[model samples]
Target chain A: MTEDTKKLLYVMTNGPENPDKTYAPIYTAALSAAMEIDTSMYFLMHAAELLKKGVAETVALKKGGSLKQFINMALENGVKFYVCEESLRDLCNIEASDVIEGVRVVGTSTLADLALDADSVISF
Target chain B: MRTECSREWDTEGELMAIINGCEIPDELHYYLEGSQMTWIRLDGENATIGLTDPAQTRAGRILHVRIKAAGTSREKGKPVATIESGKWAGPVHFPVAGTITRVNEQLELRPVLINDDPYGEGWIAQIKVTNQAEVAGLLKADQARTRFNEIIARDNVKCIRCQK
Candidate 1:
Protein backbone atom coordinates (compact mmCIF):
# COMPACT_ATOMS: atom_id res chain seq x y z
CA MET A 1 0.00 0.00 0.00
CA THR A 2 0.99 3.61 -0.34
CA GLU A 3 2.77 5.32 2.56
CA ASP A 4 -0.20 7.59 3.12
CA THR A 5 -2.47 4.60 3.42
CA LYS A 6 -0.16 2.40 5.48
CA LYS A 7 -1.44 1.52 8.92
CA LEU A 8 1.06 0.34 11.52
CA LEU A 9 -0.40 -1.76 14.33
CA TYR A 10 1.56 -2.23 17.53
CA VAL A 11 0.42 -5.30 19.44
CA MET A 12 1.37 -5.36 23.11
CA THR A 13 1.07 -8.70 24.89
CA ASN A 14 3.30 -7.69 27.76
CA GLY A 15 1.78 -6.04 30.82
CA PRO A 16 2.84 -4.20 33.95
CA GLU A 17 3.36 -7.43 35.91
CA ASN A 18 6.85 -7.90 34.53
CA PRO A 19 8.33 -4.73 33.14
CA ASP A 20 11.79 -6.12 32.51
CA LYS A 21 10.55 -9.02 30.41
CA THR A 22 8.00 -6.88 28.61
CA TYR A 23 10.29 -4.03 27.72
CA ALA A 24 10.19 -4.86 24.05
CA PRO A 25 6.55 -3.92 23.65
CA ILE A 26 6.95 -0.63 25.45
CA TYR A 27 10.02 0.17 23.38
CA THR A 28 8.19 -0.77 20.23
CA ALA A 29 5.38 1.64 21.07
CA ALA A 30 7.82 4.45 21.67
CA LEU A 31 9.74 3.61 18.54
CA SER A 32 6.52 3.68 16.55
CA ALA A 33 5.87 7.19 17.80
CA ALA A 34 9.37 8.23 16.81
CA MET A 35 8.86 6.87 13.33
CA GLU A 36 5.56 8.79 12.97
CA ILE A 37 3.77 5.96 11.17
CA ASP A 38 -0.04 5.98 11.14
CA THR A 39 0.09 3.84 14.28
CA SER A 40 -2.34 2.12 16.63
CA MET A 41 -1.60 0.11 19.78
CA TYR A 42 -3.62 -2.82 21.08
CA PHE A 43 -3.00 -4.01 24.62
CA LEU A 44 -3.92 -7.66 24.96
CA MET A 45 -3.78 -10.09 27.89
CA HIS A 46 -1.40 -8.78 30.51
CA ALA A 47 -0.62 -5.75 28.40
CA ALA A 48 -3.97 -4.20 29.28
CA GLU A 49 -2.63 -3.26 32.69
CA LEU A 50 -0.34 -0.76 31.03
CA LEU A 51 -3.34 1.52 30.66
CA LYS A 52 -3.70 1.67 34.45
CA LYS A 53 -1.99 5.07 34.64
CA GLY A 54 0.38 4.69 37.61
CA VAL A 55 1.21 1.09 36.73
CA ALA A 56 3.34 2.11 33.79
CA GLU A 57 5.62 4.25 35.96
CA THR A 58 6.55 1.31 38.18
CA VAL A 59 7.77 -0.98 35.41
CA ALA A 60 11.33 -0.51 34.21
CA LEU A 61 13.63 -2.34 31.81
CA LYS A 62 17.39 -2.28 31.60
CA LYS A 63 18.69 0.25 29.06
CA GLY A 64 15.13 1.05 28.13
CA GLY A 65 12.88 3.93 29.13
CA SER A 66 10.12 3.59 31.71
CA LEU A 67 6.87 1.99 30.61
CA LYS A 68 4.91 5.04 31.69
CA GLN A 69 7.05 7.33 29.55
CA PHE A 70 6.69 5.08 26.58
CA ILE A 71 2.94 4.91 26.85
CA ASN A 72 2.72 8.62 27.42
CA MET A 73 4.88 9.32 24.42
CA ALA A 74 2.69 7.13 22.30
CA LEU A 75 -0.48 8.78 23.50
CA GLU A 76 0.99 12.22 23.00
CA ASN A 77 1.86 11.31 19.47
CA GLY A 78 -1.75 10.26 18.75
CA VAL A 79 -1.07 6.55 18.93
CA LYS A 80 -4.55 5.06 19.39
CA PHE A 81 -4.40 2.75 22.44
CA TYR A 82 -6.97 -0.02 22.81
CA VAL A 83 -7.12 -2.29 25.86
CA CYS A 84 -8.50 -5.78 25.41
CA GLU A 85 -11.78 -6.24 27.30
CA GLU A 86 -11.12 -9.84 28.31
CA SER A 87 -7.81 -8.83 29.79
CA LEU A 88 -9.33 -5.91 31.62
CA ARG A 89 -12.00 -8.07 33.21
CA ASP A 90 -10.01 -11.27 33.78
CA LEU A 91 -6.43 -10.21 34.36
CA CYS A 92 -6.50 -6.65 35.63
CA ASN A 93 -9.71 -7.19 37.64
CA ILE A 94 -10.90 -3.81 36.51
CA GLU A 95 -13.92 -2.78 34.51
CA ALA A 96 -13.71 -0.79 31.30
CA SER A 97 -14.61 2.41 33.14
CA ASP A 98 -11.64 1.98 35.46
CA VAL A 99 -9.11 2.20 32.66
CA ILE A 100 -6.92 5.28 32.46
CA GLU A 101 -8.13 8.33 30.64
CA GLY A 102 -7.78 8.35 26.84
CA VAL A 103 -7.77 4.52 26.67
CA ARG A 104 -10.64 2.41 25.34
CA VAL A 105 -11.55 -1.20 26.07
CA VAL A 106 -12.14 -3.07 22.81
CA GLY A 107 -13.36 -6.60 22.20
CA THR A 108 -11.13 -9.46 21.03
CA SER A 109 -12.82 -9.69 17.63
CA THR A 110 -12.03 -6.08 16.94
CA LEU A 111 -8.41 -6.71 17.81
CA ALA A 112 -8.32 -9.72 15.51
CA ASP A 113 -9.88 -7.76 12.68
CA LEU A 114 -7.41 -4.92 13.20
CA ALA A 115 -4.54 -7.36 13.06
CA LEU A 116 -5.82 -8.94 9.87
CA ASP A 117 -6.38 -5.60 8.18
CA ALA A 118 -3.31 -3.68 9.29
CA ASP A 119 -0.50 -3.17 6.80
CA SER A 120 1.93 -4.26 9.52
CA VAL A 121 1.30 -5.98 12.87
CA ILE A 122 4.01 -5.98 15.52
CA SER A 123 3.55 -8.18 18.59
CA PHE A 124 5.72 -7.53 21.61
CA MET B 1 37.49 -15.98 -0.73
CA ARG B 2 37.67 -18.35 2.27
CA THR B 3 35.25 -21.25 2.96
CA GLU B 4 34.43 -22.80 6.30
CA CYS B 5 33.19 -26.35 6.96
CA SER B 6 29.48 -27.07 6.70
CA ARG B 7 27.67 -26.79 9.99
CA GLU B 8 24.09 -26.98 8.71
CA TRP B 9 22.43 -28.88 5.87
CA ASP B 10 19.41 -28.55 3.57
CA THR B 11 17.10 -31.26 2.26
CA GLU B 12 18.97 -31.25 -1.07
CA GLY B 13 22.26 -32.25 0.67
CA GLU B 14 24.20 -29.48 -0.99
CA LEU B 15 27.30 -28.76 1.10
CA MET B 16 26.78 -25.32 2.75
CA ALA B 17 29.72 -23.45 4.19
CA ILE B 18 30.38 -20.03 5.72
CA ILE B 19 31.65 -18.02 2.80
CA ASN B 20 33.48 -14.75 3.42
CA GLY B 21 32.72 -15.55 7.07
CA CYS B 22 28.98 -14.93 6.50
CA GLU B 23 26.54 -17.87 6.76
CA ILE B 24 25.61 -17.70 3.07
CA PRO B 25 25.04 -20.95 1.21
CA ASP B 26 27.27 -21.15 -1.89
CA GLU B 27 24.19 -21.54 -4.11
CA LEU B 28 23.13 -17.92 -3.71
CA HIS B 29 24.64 -14.91 -5.46
CA TYR B 30 26.08 -12.77 -2.65
CA TYR B 31 27.67 -9.53 -3.90
CA LEU B 32 28.32 -8.06 -0.46
CA GLU B 33 29.78 -10.33 2.19
CA GLY B 34 32.04 -10.12 5.29
CA SER B 35 30.91 -6.71 6.48
CA GLN B 36 29.12 -6.35 9.81
CA MET B 37 26.21 -8.22 8.16
CA THR B 38 25.40 -9.61 4.71
CA TRP B 39 23.32 -7.29 2.46
CA ILE B 40 21.85 -7.98 -0.97
CA ARG B 41 21.70 -5.27 -3.58
CA LEU B 42 18.37 -5.68 -5.42
CA ASP B 43 18.35 -6.22 -9.16
CA GLY B 44 16.11 -3.16 -9.64
CA GLU B 45 16.82 0.54 -9.15
CA ASN B 46 15.75 0.22 -5.53
CA ALA B 47 17.65 -2.18 -3.29
CA THR B 48 15.63 -4.98 -1.76
CA ILE B 49 17.32 -6.04 1.49
CA GLY B 50 17.49 -8.76 4.13
CA LEU B 51 19.99 -10.29 6.57
CA THR B 52 22.77 -12.63 5.44
CA ASP B 53 22.99 -16.32 6.36
CA PRO B 54 25.45 -15.70 9.16
CA ALA B 55 23.16 -13.01 10.57
CA GLN B 56 20.14 -15.34 10.53
CA THR B 57 22.20 -18.18 11.99
CA ARG B 58 23.15 -15.87 14.83
CA ALA B 59 19.47 -14.99 15.28
CA GLY B 60 18.28 -18.62 15.23
CA ARG B 61 14.89 -19.62 13.78
CA ILE B 62 12.87 -16.46 13.34
CA LEU B 63 9.49 -16.53 15.05
CA HIS B 64 8.36 -13.13 13.78
CA VAL B 65 9.33 -10.73 11.02
CA ARG B 66 8.11 -7.10 11.17
CA ILE B 67 8.61 -4.79 8.25
CA LYS B 68 7.90 -1.11 7.67
CA ALA B 69 5.30 -0.44 4.99
CA ALA B 70 6.09 0.64 1.44
CA GLY B 71 6.98 4.28 0.75
CA THR B 72 8.31 4.79 4.26
CA SER B 73 11.70 6.45 4.13
CA ARG B 74 14.45 4.86 6.22
CA GLU B 75 17.84 6.01 7.42
CA LYS B 76 20.96 3.90 7.79
CA GLY B 77 21.49 2.31 11.22
CA LYS B 78 17.82 2.93 12.12
CA PRO B 79 15.55 -0.04 12.56
CA VAL B 80 13.62 -0.74 9.35
CA ALA B 81 12.25 -3.96 10.74
CA THR B 82 12.39 -6.22 13.78
CA ILE B 83 12.79 -9.98 13.93
CA GLU B 84 12.12 -12.31 16.81
CA SER B 85 13.73 -15.68 17.47
CA GLY B 86 12.94 -17.84 20.46
CA LYS B 87 12.68 -15.19 23.20
CA TRP B 88 14.89 -12.50 21.72
CA ALA B 89 13.56 -9.69 19.54
CA GLY B 90 16.04 -7.52 17.69
CA PRO B 91 15.89 -4.74 15.13
CA VAL B 92 17.12 -4.94 11.53
CA HIS B 93 18.79 -1.73 10.46
CA PHE B 94 19.33 -0.65 6.91
CA PRO B 95 22.90 -0.22 5.68
CA VAL B 96 21.85 2.54 3.34
CA ALA B 97 19.16 5.22 3.27
CA GLY B 98 16.10 4.59 1.09
CA THR B 99 12.32 4.63 0.90
CA ILE B 100 10.79 1.19 1.46
CA THR B 101 9.13 0.02 -1.74
CA ARG B 102 7.82 -3.43 -0.87
CA VAL B 103 7.76 -6.01 1.93
CA ASN B 104 7.70 -9.79 1.67
CA GLU B 105 4.32 -11.27 2.62
CA GLN B 106 5.66 -14.83 2.72
CA LEU B 107 7.49 -14.04 5.96
CA GLU B 108 4.20 -13.42 7.77
CA LEU B 109 3.22 -17.07 7.44
CA ARG B 110 6.71 -18.57 7.49
CA PRO B 111 9.17 -16.68 9.60
CA VAL B 112 11.50 -19.67 9.48
CA LEU B 113 12.34 -18.84 5.86
CA ILE B 114 14.92 -16.52 7.36
CA ASN B 115 16.70 -19.63 8.63
CA ASP B 116 15.88 -22.01 5.75
CA ASP B 117 16.93 -19.60 3.00
CA PRO B 118 17.84 -16.11 4.22
CA TYR B 119 19.35 -14.92 0.96
CA GLY B 120 16.67 -16.28 -1.36
CA GLU B 121 13.00 -16.78 -0.48
CA GLY B 122 13.72 -15.10 2.85
CA TRP B 123 14.56 -11.74 1.29
CA ILE B 124 12.92 -8.97 3.36
CA ALA B 125 12.10 -5.49 2.00
CA GLN B 126 12.74 -3.67 -1.24
CA ILE B 127 13.65 0.00 -1.10
CA LYS B 128 13.66 2.79 -3.67
CA VAL B 129 17.16 3.92 -2.84
CA THR B 130 17.61 7.58 -1.93
CA ASN B 131 21.31 7.66 -2.67
CA GLN B 132 22.78 5.12 -5.06
CA ALA B 133 26.25 6.40 -4.23
CA GLU B 134 26.02 4.85 -0.75
CA VAL B 135 26.32 1.41 -2.35
CA ALA B 136 30.07 1.92 -2.58
CA GLY B 137 30.25 2.27 1.21
CA LEU B 138 29.12 -1.36 1.73
CA LEU B 139 31.71 -4.07 2.36
CA LYS B 140 32.89 -6.68 -0.14
CA ALA B 141 32.67 -10.44 0.48
CA ASP B 142 36.13 -10.76 2.06
CA GLN B 143 35.78 -7.62 4.13
CA ALA B 144 32.33 -8.74 5.32
CA ARG B 145 33.81 -12.03 6.56
CA THR B 146 36.47 -10.28 8.61
CA ARG B 147 33.89 -7.90 10.02
CA PHE B 148 31.50 -10.73 10.93
CA ASN B 149 34.30 -12.60 12.68
CA GLU B 150 35.19 -9.52 14.67
CA ILE B 151 31.57 -8.89 15.66
CA ILE B 152 31.11 -12.52 16.67
CA ALA B 153 34.29 -12.40 18.66
CA ARG B 154 33.41 -9.14 20.38
CA ASP B 155 29.85 -10.06 21.23
CA ASN B 156 30.60 -13.73 21.94
CA VAL B 157 27.07 -14.53 20.78
CA LYS B 158 26.24 -18.20 20.67
CA CYS B 159 23.33 -19.98 19.08
CA ILE B 160 20.09 -19.80 21.09
CA ARG B 161 20.14 -23.48 22.00
CA CYS B 162 23.87 -23.49 22.64
CA GLN B 163 23.64 -21.03 25.51
CA LYS B 164 22.81 -23.77 27.95
Candidate 2:
Protein backbone atom coordinates (compact mmCIF):
# COMPACT_ATOMS: atom_id res chain seq x y z
CA MET A 1 0.00 0.00 0.00
CA THR A 2 1.19 3.52 -0.77
CA GLU A 3 1.41 6.32 1.79
CA ASP A 4 -1.70 7.87 0.32
CA THR A 5 -3.65 4.62 0.36
CA LYS A 6 -6.67 5.27 2.56
CA LYS A 7 -7.83 2.97 5.38
CA LEU A 8 -11.53 2.15 5.72
CA LEU A 9 -13.26 0.34 8.57
CA TYR A 10 -16.77 -1.11 8.52
CA VAL A 11 -18.39 -2.15 11.78
CA MET A 12 -21.29 -4.63 11.50
CA THR A 13 -23.52 -5.16 14.53
CA ASN A 14 -26.31 -7.08 12.84
CA GLY A 15 -26.21 -10.85 12.37
CA PRO A 16 -28.06 -13.79 10.77
CA GLU A 17 -31.27 -12.65 12.43
CA ASN A 18 -31.10 -9.57 10.27
CA PRO A 19 -30.28 -11.10 6.93
CA ASP A 20 -31.35 -7.94 5.13
CA LYS A 21 -28.74 -5.89 6.97
CA THR A 22 -25.90 -8.44 6.65
CA TYR A 23 -24.80 -8.20 3.01
CA ALA A 24 -24.14 -4.51 2.39
CA PRO A 25 -21.23 -3.99 4.78
CA ILE A 26 -19.20 -6.99 3.57
CA TYR A 27 -20.02 -6.20 -0.06
CA THR A 28 -19.00 -2.56 0.39
CA ALA A 29 -15.82 -3.62 2.16
CA ALA A 30 -14.98 -5.85 -0.81
CA LEU A 31 -15.55 -2.95 -3.20
CA SER A 32 -13.41 -0.63 -1.08
CA ALA A 33 -10.56 -3.14 -1.13
CA ALA A 34 -10.92 -3.50 -4.89
CA MET A 35 -10.44 0.29 -5.09
CA GLU A 36 -7.03 -0.34 -3.43
CA ILE A 37 -8.05 0.98 -0.06
CA ASP A 38 -6.88 -0.90 3.01
CA THR A 39 -10.32 -2.05 4.07
CA SER A 40 -11.45 -4.06 7.11
CA MET A 41 -14.74 -5.41 8.50
CA TYR A 42 -15.27 -5.77 12.24
CA PHE A 43 -18.11 -7.97 13.50
CA LEU A 44 -19.25 -6.82 16.91
CA MET A 45 -22.18 -7.88 19.17
CA HIS A 46 -24.57 -10.24 17.37
CA ALA A 47 -22.71 -9.69 14.11
CA ALA A 48 -20.13 -12.26 15.20
CA GLU A 49 -22.77 -15.00 14.88
CA LEU A 50 -22.59 -14.76 11.09
CA LEU A 51 -18.91 -15.69 11.30
CA LYS A 52 -19.73 -19.13 12.66
CA LYS A 53 -18.79 -21.66 9.97
CA GLY A 54 -22.20 -23.02 8.97
CA VAL A 55 -24.34 -19.98 9.78
CA ALA A 56 -23.16 -17.79 6.90
CA GLU A 57 -23.42 -20.63 4.41
CA THR A 58 -27.17 -20.79 5.03
CA VAL A 59 -27.78 -17.04 5.05
CA ALA A 60 -28.72 -15.43 1.72
CA LEU A 61 -30.68 -12.47 0.46
CA LYS A 62 -33.85 -12.90 -1.55
CA LYS A 63 -32.00 -11.93 -4.72
CA GLY A 64 -29.48 -14.82 -4.50
CA GLY A 65 -26.14 -16.07 -3.14
CA SER A 66 -25.22 -16.92 0.44
CA LEU A 67 -23.40 -14.63 2.86
CA LYS A 68 -20.31 -16.82 2.50
CA GLN A 69 -20.01 -15.73 -1.12
CA PHE A 70 -19.74 -12.08 -0.09
CA ILE A 71 -17.35 -13.08 2.69
CA ASN A 72 -15.21 -14.89 0.14
CA MET A 73 -15.33 -11.84 -2.14
CA ALA A 74 -14.13 -9.61 0.70
CA LEU A 75 -11.37 -12.04 1.61
CA GLU A 76 -10.27 -12.43 -2.03
CA ASN A 77 -9.92 -8.63 -2.35
CA GLY A 78 -7.59 -8.57 0.67
CA VAL A 79 -10.07 -7.14 3.15
CA LYS A 80 -9.23 -8.01 6.71
CA PHE A 81 -11.89 -9.79 8.83
CA TYR A 82 -12.06 -9.24 12.57
CA VAL A 83 -14.50 -10.51 15.18
CA CYS A 84 -14.98 -9.22 18.71
CA GLU A 85 -13.57 -11.91 21.02
CA GLU A 86 -15.97 -11.15 23.85
CA SER A 87 -18.95 -11.47 21.51
CA LEU A 88 -17.64 -14.74 20.14
CA ARG A 89 -16.98 -16.34 23.52
CA ASP A 90 -19.64 -14.81 25.77
CA LEU A 91 -22.38 -13.52 23.53
CA CYS A 92 -22.29 -16.11 20.71
CA ASN A 93 -21.01 -18.93 22.92
CA ILE A 94 -18.66 -19.98 20.12
CA GLU A 95 -14.90 -20.49 20.30
CA ALA A 96 -12.38 -19.02 17.86
CA SER A 97 -12.29 -22.45 16.22
CA ASP A 98 -16.03 -22.29 15.49
CA VAL A 99 -15.82 -19.29 13.17
CA ILE A 100 -15.05 -19.38 9.47
CA GLU A 101 -11.50 -19.15 8.18
CA GLY A 102 -9.55 -15.92 7.47
CA VAL A 103 -10.89 -14.11 10.54
CA ARG A 104 -8.86 -12.54 13.37
CA VAL A 105 -10.39 -12.56 16.85
CA VAL A 106 -9.47 -9.45 18.75
CA GLY A 107 -10.38 -7.59 21.94
CA THR A 108 -12.42 -4.36 22.24
CA SER A 109 -9.18 -2.38 22.51
CA THR A 110 -8.26 -3.39 18.97
CA LEU A 111 -11.56 -2.00 17.61
CA ALA A 112 -10.80 1.27 19.41
CA ASP A 113 -7.38 1.41 17.79
CA LEU A 114 -8.86 0.57 14.40
CA ALA A 115 -11.48 3.30 14.73
CA LEU A 116 -8.79 5.80 15.71
CA ASP A 117 -6.38 4.87 12.92
CA ALA A 118 -8.92 4.43 10.14
CA ASP A 119 -9.37 7.25 7.65
CA SER A 120 -13.10 6.56 7.61
CA VAL A 121 -15.40 4.37 9.68
CA ILE A 122 -18.94 3.22 8.87
CA SER A 123 -21.30 1.30 11.13
CA PHE A 124 -24.17 -1.01 10.21
CA MET B 1 -18.43 2.20 -38.53
CA ARG B 2 -14.96 2.42 -36.95
CA THR B 3 -12.25 2.19 -39.59
CA GLU B 4 -9.55 -0.43 -39.11
CA CYS B 5 -5.79 0.06 -39.39
CA SER B 6 -3.71 -2.54 -41.21
CA ARG B 7 -1.34 -4.35 -38.84
CA GLU B 8 -0.11 -7.96 -38.96
CA TRP B 9 -1.57 -8.65 -35.50
CA ASP B 10 -4.88 -6.84 -36.06
CA THR B 11 -7.85 -9.22 -36.06
CA GLU B 12 -10.17 -6.77 -37.82
CA GLY B 13 -11.80 -8.16 -40.99
CA GLU B 14 -11.06 -11.67 -39.78
CA LEU B 15 -14.02 -14.02 -39.54
CA MET B 16 -14.34 -14.16 -35.77
CA ALA B 17 -16.07 -17.34 -34.61
CA ILE B 18 -19.44 -17.17 -32.85
CA ILE B 19 -19.56 -19.92 -30.26
CA ASN B 20 -22.69 -19.81 -28.11
CA GLY B 21 -23.20 -16.36 -29.70
CA CYS B 22 -19.96 -15.10 -28.13
CA GLU B 23 -17.44 -13.59 -30.54
CA ILE B 24 -13.91 -14.89 -30.17
CA PRO B 25 -11.62 -12.86 -32.44
CA ASP B 26 -8.70 -14.59 -34.11
CA GLU B 27 -5.13 -13.58 -33.09
CA LEU B 28 -6.03 -11.60 -29.95
CA HIS B 29 -4.51 -13.14 -26.80
CA TYR B 30 -6.58 -13.95 -23.72
CA TYR B 31 -6.19 -14.46 -19.99
CA LEU B 32 -8.87 -16.51 -18.20
CA GLU B 33 -9.23 -16.47 -14.43
CA GLY B 34 -11.99 -18.80 -13.30
CA SER B 35 -14.93 -17.64 -15.49
CA GLN B 36 -13.60 -14.09 -16.02
CA MET B 37 -12.03 -13.36 -19.42
CA THR B 38 -9.54 -10.56 -20.24
CA TRP B 39 -7.72 -9.96 -23.54
CA ILE B 40 -4.42 -8.31 -24.47
CA ARG B 41 -3.33 -6.83 -27.81
CA LEU B 42 0.41 -6.31 -28.21
CA ASP B 43 1.56 -3.26 -30.19
CA GLY B 44 5.35 -2.96 -30.26
CA GLU B 45 6.26 -2.36 -26.56
CA ASN B 46 2.75 -1.32 -25.57
CA ALA B 47 -0.36 -3.46 -24.96
CA THR B 48 -4.06 -2.70 -24.97
CA ILE B 49 -6.31 -4.75 -22.70
CA GLY B 50 -10.04 -5.24 -22.11
CA LEU B 51 -12.72 -7.74 -21.13
CA THR B 52 -13.71 -10.35 -23.72
CA ASP B 53 -17.21 -10.46 -25.20
CA PRO B 54 -18.35 -13.36 -23.03
CA ALA B 55 -17.10 -11.66 -19.87
CA GLN B 56 -19.04 -8.45 -20.56
CA THR B 57 -22.17 -10.43 -21.37
CA ARG B 58 -21.82 -12.37 -18.14
CA ALA B 59 -21.36 -9.15 -16.18
CA GLY B 60 -24.76 -7.94 -17.44
CA ARG B 61 -25.06 -4.14 -17.77
CA ILE B 62 -22.12 -2.31 -16.27
CA LEU B 63 -23.09 0.58 -13.97
CA HIS B 64 -19.74 1.94 -12.81
CA VAL B 65 -16.03 1.71 -13.58
CA ARG B 66 -12.98 3.02 -11.70
CA ILE B 67 -9.66 2.70 -13.48
CA LYS B 68 -6.24 3.53 -12.12
CA ALA B 69 -4.77 6.73 -13.61
CA ALA B 70 -2.12 6.89 -16.29
CA GLY B 71 1.45 6.50 -14.99
CA THR B 72 0.33 4.15 -12.24
CA SER B 73 2.48 1.00 -12.10
CA ARG B 74 0.85 -2.37 -11.56
CA GLU B 75 2.23 -5.87 -11.35
CA LYS B 76 0.82 -8.71 -13.42
CA GLY B 77 -2.39 -10.13 -11.88
CA LYS B 78 -3.00 -6.78 -10.14
CA PRO B 79 -6.20 -4.78 -10.79
CA VAL B 80 -6.13 -1.99 -13.37
CA ALA B 81 -9.79 -1.20 -12.75
CA THR B 82 -12.85 -2.10 -10.70
CA ILE B 83 -16.10 -2.54 -12.58
CA GLU B 84 -19.62 -2.93 -11.18
CA SER B 85 -22.46 -4.36 -13.17
CA GLY B 86 -26.00 -5.44 -12.36
CA LYS B 87 -24.90 -9.02 -11.66
CA TRP B 88 -21.30 -8.69 -10.57
CA ALA B 89 -18.64 -6.28 -9.30
CA GLY B 90 -14.88 -6.79 -9.00
CA PRO B 91 -11.44 -5.83 -10.20
CA VAL B 92 -10.22 -6.25 -13.77
CA HIS B 93 -6.78 -7.76 -13.44
CA PHE B 94 -3.79 -6.68 -15.53
CA PRO B 95 -2.59 -9.50 -17.79
CA VAL B 96 1.02 -8.34 -17.71
CA ALA B 97 3.19 -6.05 -15.63
CA GLY B 98 3.45 -2.44 -16.84
CA THR B 99 2.81 1.22 -16.14
CA ILE B 100 -0.61 2.39 -17.32
CA THR B 101 -0.41 4.79 -20.27
CA ARG B 102 -4.14 5.43 -20.76
CA VAL B 103 -7.57 4.53 -19.41
CA ASN B 104 -10.92 4.65 -21.22
CA GLU B 105 -12.28 7.90 -19.80
CA GLN B 106 -15.48 7.47 -21.81
CA LEU B 107 -16.45 4.71 -19.37
CA GLU B 108 -17.17 7.32 -16.69
CA LEU B 109 -20.02 8.67 -18.84
CA ARG B 110 -21.07 5.49 -20.64
CA PRO B 111 -20.22 2.47 -18.57
CA VAL B 112 -22.55 0.40 -20.73
CA LEU B 113 -19.94 0.67 -23.49
CA ILE B 114 -18.51 -2.40 -21.86
CA ASN B 115 -21.68 -4.24 -22.85
CA ASP B 116 -22.03 -2.57 -26.27
CA ASP B 117 -18.46 -3.01 -27.51
CA PRO B 118 -16.25 -4.81 -25.05
CA TYR B 119 -13.53 -5.52 -27.59
CA GLY B 120 -13.39 -2.12 -29.27
CA GLU B 121 -14.56 1.21 -27.81
CA GLY B 122 -14.77 -0.38 -24.36
CA TRP B 123 -11.05 -1.15 -24.20
CA ILE B 124 -9.91 -0.61 -20.59
CA ALA B 125 -6.25 0.38 -20.39
CA GLN B 126 -3.06 0.80 -22.41
CA ILE B 127 0.16 -0.28 -20.74
CA LYS B 128 3.84 0.38 -21.40
CA VAL B 129 5.41 -3.01 -20.95
CA THR B 130 7.99 -3.35 -18.19
CA ASN B 131 8.48 -7.09 -18.82
CA GLN B 132 8.02 -8.59 -22.26
CA ALA B 133 8.34 -12.22 -21.13
CA GLU B 134 5.11 -12.03 -19.13
CA VAL B 135 3.13 -11.41 -22.35
CA ALA B 136 4.40 -14.54 -24.10
CA GLY B 137 2.21 -17.22 -22.53
CA LEU B 138 -1.24 -15.65 -22.96
CA LEU B 139 -3.72 -17.97 -24.75
CA LYS B 140 -4.03 -17.18 -28.44
CA ALA B 141 -7.31 -17.26 -30.37
CA ASP B 142 -7.51 -21.00 -31.17
CA GLN B 143 -6.52 -21.93 -27.60
CA ALA B 144 -8.90 -19.44 -26.01
CA ARG B 145 -11.72 -20.59 -28.30
CA THR B 146 -11.48 -24.11 -26.89
CA ARG B 147 -11.56 -22.82 -23.33
CA PHE B 148 -14.32 -20.24 -23.89
CA ASN B 149 -16.47 -22.86 -25.58
CA GLU B 150 -16.19 -25.09 -22.55
CA ILE B 151 -16.97 -22.26 -20.15
CA ILE B 152 -19.88 -21.06 -22.26
CA ALA B 153 -21.41 -24.51 -22.23
CA ARG B 154 -20.69 -25.10 -18.57
CA ASP B 155 -22.13 -21.77 -17.50
CA ASN B 156 -25.04 -21.92 -20.02
CA VAL B 157 -24.08 -18.48 -21.39
CA LYS B 158 -25.65 -16.92 -24.48
CA CYS B 159 -24.02 -13.62 -25.37
CA ILE B 160 -26.21 -10.60 -26.12
CA ARG B 161 -25.00 -7.14 -27.12
CA CYS B 162 -26.89 -4.12 -25.84
CA GLN B 163 -28.45 -1.94 -28.55
CA LYS B 164 -27.10 1.59 -28.88
Which of the numbered candidates is closest to the native, going by highest DockQ?
Answer: 2
lDDT for each candidate structure: 0.65, 0.83
Clashing pairs in 2: none
Estimate the lDDT of model 2. 0.83
For candidate 2, write residues B48-139 as lDDT tens digits: 99998888876667889999999999888888999876235678888889999999999999988888888899999999988889878689
The alpha-carbon interface RMSD of model 2 comes to 2.3
After superposition, candidate 2 runs with Cα above 4 Å error: B1-20, B33-36, B145-160
Q: Least accurate stretch of 10 residues (summed lDDT) in model 1 chain B?
A: B2-11
Model 1 misplacement above 4 A: A1-124, B1-38, B42-44, B155-164
Model 1, span A13-123: residue lDDT tens: 877677775666654654554454567889888888878757777777564336664565456545688888999898779778778888877898888888887889987
DockQ of model 2, rounded to 2 decimals: 0.29
Structure candidate 1, residue pairs in collision: B23-B54, B33-B144, B34-B143, B34-B144, B34-B145, B35-B144
How big is the RMSD of model 2? 7.6
TM-score of each: 0.48, 0.82
Q: Which candidate has the highest lDDT of all?
A: 2
